[model samples]
Target: MFHKILIANRGEIALRVLRAAKELGIQTVAVHSTADAEAMHVRLADESVCIGPPPSRDSYLNIHQIVAACEITGADAVHPGYGFLSENAKFADILDAHNITFIGPRADHIRVMGDKIEAKRTAKRLGIPVVPGSDGAVTEDAEAKRIAAEIGYPVIIKASAGGGGRGMKVARNEDDIDVALATARSEAGAAFGDDAVYIEKYLEKPRHIEVQVVGDGDGRAVHLGERDCSLQRRHQKVWEEANSPALNAADRSRIGMTVANAMADLKYAGAGTIEFLYENGEFYFIEMNTRLQVEHPVTEAITGIDLVHEQIRVASGAGLSVEQKDVQFNGHAIECRINAEDPKTFAPSPGTVSHFHTPGGLGVRVDSAVFSGYKIPPYYDSLIGKLIVHGSNRVECMMRLRRALGEFVVDGIKTTLPLFQDLVNSRDIANGDYDIHWLEKYLAKADT
Candidate 1:
C-alpha cells in the first residue's frame, strides 16, 4: 500500500484521486500551479505544493517540478489524473527511474497506444477488428491518394498523432483527396508537430463505443462493459452512457471479451480503454486510451467498482481480485459533461462562479471541484463537472438525468445546460437512436 501519493494534475480529477487515496488510508499531496493555490484539491489535500506559474507547460506538464514536489513531500506513488501527463510515456519512465510508482499502465503500453497508427496495427494483430486503411502512415499525397482509392471513396485522412477531431479531414471523392491530404498533414503538423497522416475508409453514422479494461500487470485483464460516447461536438464527448444502446447482449459480450483478451495478450497493466466505431453491428477499432477516461464515471456506476482504487492497487503490484465471471454489469448509467460554454455557440465560458448548487438524489452523482466564488481558469479544458445518473433501465436513467440537469444551478457564467435539457426531451434521444454524427447535425440544424 502507498503511504503517500502525489497527484500530478488539477481540478475535479485531482480531487477524485485525492478522495480515492484517502479512502484507502493513504495521505495525498496536491501539486498545483500558483493560479490554483486556492483550488479545492489543494485545500483538501494533506499537503500542497505550488509547482509553477499558471500555464500548463510551466506547471502541470512540467515533469521536473512535479517530481521535485513528490521528492519533497516523500510521496511514494504518483496518480496522474486523466489528462496532462497521464498518458505520457516519458513521464512514466522518468517516474520509474526515480523509483516512484506511476499509478497507470506500463510505459511501453502508453508509448504504443499513444500513436494512432501503431494502436490500430496492435489492435489488428491482436485479432481485434480494425477499420480498413493504409498499412502504415501515408506520408506522400500520391500514396494517400492511392490508399484512399484502394480503400474506396469517402476515406478519412487522420493524423498519426491526432485526436479530439483535430488534424482530420474526410474526402468523399477523388477530387477532394488532394486537398484533404494536404490540409490534414498541415493541420496535424501544426497541432502535434508531426505531419504524418493515414487513411481509413469512413463509416457513416457510426456509434462511438469504448470498452473499459483493467489489467493486473500479470497478463490478466477483464472488461467492465462498454460506454456509448456517440453524443459529441467538435470531437469532444458531451454525453456518455454505459451498456451501449446500439449493442445487443451478445454483441456487447463479444466485444467486451475481445478487448479483455487483447489486453491480456499485450500484458497491459492498470486501466485502459479500447475505443471503437460501431456501424451495422460491426465494431472497428479506433484507438486505445492508456489511462482513465473522462467518461469513466458511467462505467464505475454500472460496475460498482472504483477504477482509481483498482489502478492504484495494480500499480502497487496487486492482482485484480475480481475475475471475468465475478464482474457483473448492473443498471444503466448516463453521464453529462457539464462544460462552461455557450449552449448554442460552444464558446468557452471561464469566470467566477457566483452560485453553485448540486443536485441530490439516490442515483445522481456530481463529480466537481467548483463552488461559489471559485474562479475557473481559462488555461484548462472547459469541462467544469460531470453529472452522472444511474437507474434500473435506460428510460429511468434518462428521466433521472433530465431531473438532475434541471436542478443543477450555476450562475455568473454560461454553460451547456440548456443543450442537454433539450436533448433529454427529444424523441430521437429518448429512443437512444443517435450516432456519432447526430449531435453535430442536430446543432447544425439549430443554427438555421
Candidate 2:
C-alpha cells in the first residue's frame, strides 16, 4: 500500500475514501478549494491543501494545482472519489507521467469505456447484449434520418461522450429526428466536446440496472451485485437500491459474469461499474462508470464489502480478497440522495445549516459533510448527503428508510427530503413496479 494517498475530490465521498484509508493504515491528504477550506474531508485528512479558489476549473478540476498539491504533500497515490476528473483519461496519463499511482482503472480502459459508441462495440465483441443503435456516429442529417427509420420511432439520440441526461433527445417521428439530432449534437459538443452522436431505440419504462465489479490488476475480477437506479429525474439517478426487484438470480449471475469476463480479458484494474438498461426481461449495455459510483454505499450495505479498501488493495498489486463463491447477497439496501434544493421549485438552496440532525440506529447510514454553521457552497453539486438503509428484506428496508428520512433534520436550507418522503410512501415505489420515469410523473402531479 502507498505510504500516503491524496484524495482528489470533496464532500462525503472524499470523507468516505478517508475512512477506508484510515482503516487500512494508510495516510491521507485532502485537496480542497478555498470554498471548501473548512470541509469535513479536509478536517479529517492528515494533511490538507488549498488547490485554488471556488471555481472548479481552477480548483477541483485543475490538474496542475492538484498535481502540485500531491507533490507538496508527498502523496504517492491519488484517489479520485467520483465525478470531476475521476474518469478523465488525460489526467490519468498525467499521473503516470509524474510516476504517481492513480487508484483507478488504466488510462486505456477509461478511454474505451468513456466513449458510449466504443463501449457498445466492445460489448458486442464480447457477446454482451446491447441496444440496437446506429453504426458508430452519424455525421449528416440524412444519415441520422436513415438510422432512425431503421430503428423505428421513439429513438434516443445520445452524445458519444455524454451522461447525466445531457446531449440526449427522444424523437418519435422523422420530422423530430433531424431537429433532435442537430440539437443533441450541438449540446454534446458544448457539454463533452464530442459532437459525435448515436441513435438507439428508446425503451419506455426501462429499469436502469448496473453490476459492480472489482478487479485485481492481474486479470482477476468478481462482481459484488447489481443496483436498480430506475428512479431518476431527467436521466439522473435520485434513488438506488440493491438486489433489484427487476432481476432474478440467473439474470444477475449472467450479467455479473459477463462484465467480469470482459474486464478480465481487457486486464482492467480496480473498481468499475457496467451500467445497463433493462426492459421486458432483457438487458442492454449502456456505459461503464470508471470510478466509484455515488450509489456505492447501498451495494456495500448488502454485500458487507468495503469497495475503497478493495480499490486500494488492487492498486497495490494485491488480489481481491473475496472470490465469486465467497460473494453473497444478504439483504435489500436503499439509498436516497438528500440534496440542498427546493422541493417545490427543484432549484439549489445553498446556505448555512442552523441545525443538523442525522438518523441513527440499526441499518441506517448517513454520509454527509454538513453540520451546524456549515454553509453549502453553490459552486458545486447540490447533494448534501445520502440516506442509506438496509434490512433483512425489501419491505423492511423501505419502512426503515421512510422512518430514517423523517428523523433527518437540516435547518435553514430547503431539501428534497420531503420529496423523497412522498416517493417512499407512494404506491408505485411500495410495490417496486415503477420505472425510470416514475419520479418525473409523480412530481408532475404535485401542486407545485
Candidate 3:
C-alpha cells in the first residue's frame, strides 16, 4: 500500500478517496485551489496545500502545481477522483516520469479509452457489440452526408472527444445534416480542442447501462454487475440504480463477463466502467470511463465491495483478492445526485448554506462535504452531494429514496431536490420506463 497519497481533486470525491486511504493506514494530502481553502476535504485530510487560484486551469488542472504538492508532502501516490484530470493520460505519464504511482489504469489504457471513436473500434475488436456508425472520423461534409445516408435518418453526430452532451447534434433528415456537422465541429473544437466528430445510428429509447469492472493489471479482473443510468437530462446522469430493472440475469452475466474478459485481455489496472446503450434487447457500446464513476456507490451498496480500496490495492501491485465466483449481488440500490442548481431553470446556485440536514436510516447513505455554513463556490461543478439508498428490491429502494429526499434539506439555495421529489412520484420513473431522453421530454412537457 502507498505510505501517503495526494488527492488531485476537490469536493466530495476528494473526501471519498481520503477516507478510503486512511482506512488502509495510508496518510493523505489534499490539494485545492484558493477558492476551496475552506473545503471539507481540505479540513479532513492529514495534510493540505493550496495549489493555485480559483480557476481550475490554474489549480486542479495544473499538473505542475499538483506534482509540487505531492513532492512537498512526500506522497508516494496520487488519486484523482473523477472529473478534472482523472482520465488525462498525460497526467498519468507525468506521474510515471516522476516515479509517483497513479492509483488508476495505465497511461496507455487511458489513452485508448479517452477518445470516443477509438474506444468504439476497440470495443468492437474486443467482441463487444457497438452501434453502427462511420468507419472512422467523418471530416468532410460529403463524407458525413454519405455516412448519414448509409445509417438512415435520425442519426446523431458526436464529438470524438466530447461528453456531457456538448458538441453533439441530431439530424433527422438530410437538411439538418450540414448545420449539425458545422455546429458539432465548432463545438467539439471549443470544448475538447479536437474538432473530430463521428456519426452513429441513434436509437430513440436506449437505456444507458454500464458494467463495473476492477482489474489487477496482470491478466486478472472481476465484475460487480451493472447500473442503469437512463434517467438523464442534457446527457448528464441524475439518478442511477444497481441491478438494472431493464436487464435480465442472463444478459447481466453475459455483459459482466465480457467486460471483465476485455479488461483482462488489455491487462487493465484498477477500476473502470464499460458503458453501453441498450435498445430493445441488444446492448450497443457507447464508451468506456477509465476511472471511478460518481454512480459507483450504488454498485458498492448492492455488491458489498469497496471499489476505492480495490483500486488502491491493485495500484499497489496486489492481485484481486475476490474472484468472479466470490462476487455476490444482494438487493437493489439507488443514487440521486443532489446538485446546487435550480429544479426548474437548472441554473447554477452558489452561495452559503443557511441550514443543512441529511437523512439517515436503515439502508440510506449520504455522501457530501457541505455543512450548514459551507459556501458553494461558483468556479466548480454544481454537484454538492449524493443521496444513496438500498433495499430488498427496486420498489423498496425508490420508497426509501423518496423518503430520504423529503428529509434532505439545504436551505437558502436552489437545488434539484424538488426535481427528485417530483421524479419519485412519476409513473414512468416508478415503472423504470425511462430512457436517456425521457427526463428531457418530461421537462419539456412541464413547460406547457
Candidate 1: TM-score? 0.99
The best candidate by lDDT is 3
TM-score of 2: 0.98
Give Cα-based local distance difference scores for all models. 0.93, 0.92, 0.94
Clashes of each: 0, 0, 0
Per-residue C-alpha lDDT of model 1 across residues 60-135, encoded as one tens digit per residue: 9999999999899999999998989999999999999999999999899998998999999999999999999998
Per-residue CA lDDT of model 3 for 152-213, tens digit only, reads 98999999999999999999988898999999999999998999999999898899999999
Residues 1-448 of candidate 2 have per-residue lDDT tens digits of 7899999999999999999999999999999999999999999999999999999999999999999998998999999999989999999999999999999999998999999999999888877789988869987878888888887888999999999899999999888987898999999999988899999999987999999999887878899989999999888889999999988899999889998888887778999999999999999999999999999999999999999999999988776889989999999999999999998888999999999999988999999989899999999999999999999999999999989988999999999999888888888888999888888887788855
**What stretches of model 3 exceed 4 Å from their correct place?**
none
Candidate 2 wrong stretches, greater than 4 Å = none
What is the C-alpha local distance difference test score of candidate 3?
0.94
Greater-TM-score candidate between 1 and 2: 1
